[model samples]
Target: MDTARENRTWGALSDLPGHPMMWVLILTETVTFGLLFAIFAITGVVHSDVFSAGRAQLDPVLGGVNTLVLITSGWLAALAVEARVIGRRTIARLLLAGAAALGCVFTAIKVVEYATKVSVGIGLETDTFFTLYFLATGFHLLHVILGVIIIAAVAMYDSLDNLKTGTAFWHMVDLVWVVMYPLIYLVG
Candidate 1:
């Protein structure tokens, strides 16, 4: 009975999308971000005034634009995976390029957002809200940069499995940002 259960577990894992290891990364990242999000929420309630002021300072328009950019990038990444599965290597590469380009745009917008904050002297020490804001968004920005690099590498390599794995990472990055935008930008 134990052997049967073990085999069932392994079989379920094997049927997951992308590389099994990539799912591991997705699960790990999701848990980490979830913890940060909960902390941010609890801290917001504890320091409601600080969080409100911090949210007011942020540019929701820019955050909305970034959200759209990431969503579209995720779509392109998905398309690239589909194209790869269909043996359309060139199309898949093009799709990946589009995805990576959007990733670059997202990164650029985030840098601009950070620069705007810094120009006004709003560093991480500004308050509890700013501290969590910088830490969470900065960590997410790092993932975007890494996702772009991985997408480019996958495009060059152009294997179906590699494309699926790399795009899966990209989608994970996108998912984080989608959840984060409203929480960090609009929640009050």
Candidate 2:
């Protein structure tokens, strides 16, 4: 309790959704991804032709579909948090489980995209664009996988702090993808 109170000196971050520690993780990760994203954008501007050529090989429609999937999952996660707040354990659990299921769906689609890339001889080593594509998306995918585990653990545990923290992390995952889709797919 004292530690949590001490953390509150930082202001909104201490009071933000989820555990204080979770907020710290979220902030750290946000900065990390922000830097990576900026680098990607800068690289694109420097090597416009290569970036455009790489973007041309990607399927924007698939990225769009994944965006929708992630948004829906984030919504479900929000609902889970709401339900937990209202003393509806069963509903919260169901919603968290559903959110995790949607994460799985996102992973499945990514796997298919990767397999397609492999079949077409496109890989991280293929080109600069492909390398950046794999690095950014692959890193995000790791977060999605971690979020699933966190969500599932929170569901079974049914602790308010854990629920809030886990769902917040999941939302972060969703957010990164939302930004990534436009950069890696739509921007060209």
Candidate 3:
């Protein structure tokens, strides 16, 4: 009876899951990003002049557009997860594709922005502010790239169950951008 009960419990836990591993992964990622943000905050406070000057060089309009793109992608991803939960596999795939495409758009824009900055002689070596700006944004861009990959993986999966795991990771990526957008674009 005890063996049967144990088997039942294991089955219930594993079978009733939607990306059980994603929560732990997301938690670790959040802590890493949180530390990066804290470092930036401390540096900004202590070196306001450098940060302010570096920020002045940034094109707020471009940043604003990127922010919009990320937010929209996040919305789409959330919808995709909902669709999956409801067993609408086609809609979920479409939404996941849309989210992935938006991520590509974001990366393209960032490339252009970075090229423009480099052409104008503004780079990581320019100043303390530029250094921090590039480091933070570059790290975030890496996350975006990873998100694109994950979303693409979800798009390729034939089963909703498989796609659900990728969606969870994508959601965490979206959450990070929501925090980053306001912090990097508006507050400075």
Candidate 4:
């Protein structure tokens, strides 16, 4: 109600672990990815055969490896938050670096996968399945790139708030893949 109360109320939001802005962004990203997943599911249901063949063309082993890598990156990002909290700025920076490196590795693998698709003459208009695959994963890949940039900034700036915000973004990226791996690669 009063000014102090309002400030306190806003500050209370900060006490919930990460920055509130980061949480808001995470919610936005989640909704966007959720809609994409829904679209994928509906499209797959309509063209079941094409979707099945598309999933088969994808290498589940590579998807699994990337899943492992991203999860580890998310863990490292969490550690970065802990390290920053305890005044271990250097360690936090190093951990952020590790996380960003893992994200880049994931991106590289995606690039290779895209190349494989290209070589096989699979373009955006190749079919409904390929179109959805590229749209979903390619959008996710952009998020990965943005997450890496956030990691770099947090590592250099080195604050509890920065670490929390950056890692929040990184974790969202990882979460998207967790759904995407099964939805686009393993399932029909």
* Candidate models: Cα lDDT each: 0.93, 0.92, 0.80, 0.89
Best-fitting candidate, scored by lDDT: 1
Pairs of colliding residues, candidate 4: none
Instruction: Give stretches of model 2 more than 4 Å off.
Output: 1-12
Clashing pairs in 2: none
* Alpha-carbon RMSD, each predicted model: 2.9, 1.9, 3.5, 2.0
Q: Estimate each model's TM-score.
A: 0.94, 0.94, 0.85, 0.93
Q: Which of candidates 2 and 3 reaches a greater lDDT? A: 2
Task: Quote the positional error of residue 63 for candidate 4 in Å.
Answer: 0.9
What would the per-residue lDDT of candidate 3 be over residues 1-188, giving only the tens digit for each residue? 78777556445344433555666677788998899788888888999888788777788889889888988998898788788888888998899899999999999999999999999999889987778778878988998999899888877773666676776777777788778766665675
lDDT of 2 by residue, 50-75 (tens): 99998999999999999999999999
Tell me how far candidate 2 lies from the true structure as C-alpha RMSD in angstroms.
1.9
**Deviation from native of the Cα of residue 28 in model 2, angstroms:** 0.9
Clashing pairs in 3: none
The C-alpha stretches of model 3 lying farther than 4 A from their native spots are: 1-17
| lDDT per residue as tens, model 4, 83-157 | 888998888888889999999999999999899989989888988999999999999999999999989988988
